[model samples]
Target: MKQVEIISGGPELLDIVEPLWAKLNEYHKKRSTHFSHKFEQLTFEKRKQNLLKEACDVTINLIVDQTNNAYVGYCICTVNKEKQGEIDSLFIENEYRKYGLGAELINRSITWLENYQAQTIVIGVSEGNEHALDFYQKFGFYKRRYILERE
Candidate 1:
C-alpha cells in the first residue's frame, strides 16, 4: 500500500500541478463538444495568474503520492459571503479513479467549506457527463438549475 498526502495551498502550487492541469483541460475538451475554449490561447504564465486570482477566494487541495512526490489529484472549492459553497473543480488521474481518491478529495473539500459555515454546497456537472452527475448524486447532491446554452 502507498501513502497518499493531501496538501492545501494557493495558486503557487500550480507549478507542481501544471502537467496534470493540462491533462484535465484536455479531458474536459474531449468529453464535451461545447467545451471549445481554446486553452492553448493562454500561456502558462497567464494561466498561473488566472489561477492566482481564483485562489483569492477558494481553497485548493492537491493529493500526492508521498513516496514519489507526484500530484495525482486535486479539488478546488469556494465559499461565498452568502455562506454558499461551490466545488469549482475536481479531477483524478484515470489510473487513480478506482481507489476512492476522488471521493476523499470531495469529502475534504466539503468538510473545509462546512467549517467556514457554508449553508449550501453545489457542484457543476458538465451537461453530458452522466458519470460525474452520478458521482455527486451519491453524495446527496441534486439538480438545482439547468444552464442551457446555444453556440
Candidate 2:
C-alpha cells in the first residue's frame, strides 16, 4: 500500500484539485437525478469558476499518494462569521475508499474550523448517500435539517 499525505492549502492549488471536484460533481449527479438538470445548466468553465470561488473561501486539503505523487482526494471547509463551520465538499477516489482517508480529511477540516473558533460544524450529505451520511455520523454528525425542492 502506498502512503497517503494530506496537504493543506488554498485556491492556489485549484488546478490540482479541479479533477477531483469534477468527479465529485459527477458522483452526486448520478446519486440524485435532480442534480443532473442543475449540472447541465452550467458550462464547464462556469462550473470551474464556481469551484474556484468555493475553494477561495475555504481551506482546501488534498490527499496525495506519496509514492507516485498523485492527487487522489480533496476536502473544502470554511468558517462563517457566526462561528459555524461548513464542510462544502469531500471526495475520495474509489481506489482509496477503505483506507480512512475520508476520515482524515474530515478531521483536518474540523480542526481548521475549530481553530477559527467555529461553534458548530456541518457537512452537507446528498439525500440518497447513506454511506456518506453514515461515515460522518461515525464522527458525531447527525441530521439537523432537510431540504425539500419543487420545480
Candidate 3:
C-alpha cells in the first residue's frame, strides 16, 4: 500500500476539493444517514471558499493522497485565538473508510495547532455520529458540550 501524503490545498485543488465536498454534502443531506441535518445549515460554496482562503494563509487545509497521487481525504484546521484550535471539517471517501486516514488527519491537525502554539484542538461531531465520536475519543477528545436545536 502506498503511503498517504499531505499537500497544501490551493486553486489547483479546487476542482478536486469541490467535488469531494459536494459528495460529502450529499451524504450529509440524506435524511436516513447519520450525518443528515447536522450540517444542512451551512452553505457549501461559501464554506468551501472560506476553507480555501484559510489554507492560503493562517490555517491549513491538508489534502491527503496516495503515493500514486490519487486524492483520498482532507481536513481543515483553523486556529481560534479566543479558544482552542478547531478542526473545521474532515472527510474521507466512503471507499477509504477504516483505513486510518481520519486518524491521520486529526493527528496532523493537532500537530499544526501545537506548532502554532494553540492551547488545544476542538472538533464538533453530530449527536448521532457515534463513529466520529469514537474516533475522536480514541485520540483523547471528549464531549465538552452539547448543542440542541428545535426544528
Instruction: Compare the candidates by lDDT and give the number of the best one.
Output: 2
User: What does candidate 1's lDDT look like per residue over 1-151, in tens digits?
Assistant: 4578889975557677677777766766677766546443545567566545544357889988888888888887877667778887787887778888888888888898888788889897764465788788877898888988785
Per-residue lDDT for 31-109 in model 2, tens only? 7755666644655467547655543256889999998999999987876566778888788999998898889998888
- Encode model 3's per-residue lDDT on 27-138: one tens digit a residue: 6576324446656765667886675554422444545655567777777677654546778777887767777778877887788778877777788765455567877888
* Candidate whose TM-score is highest: 2
> Which regions of candidate 2 fall more than 4 Å away from where they truly are?
42-57
* Candidate 1 residue runs with Cα over 4 Å from true position: 37-56
Better of 1 and 2 by lDDT: 2
Candidate 1 accuracy as TM-score: 0.82
Clash pairs for candidate 2: none
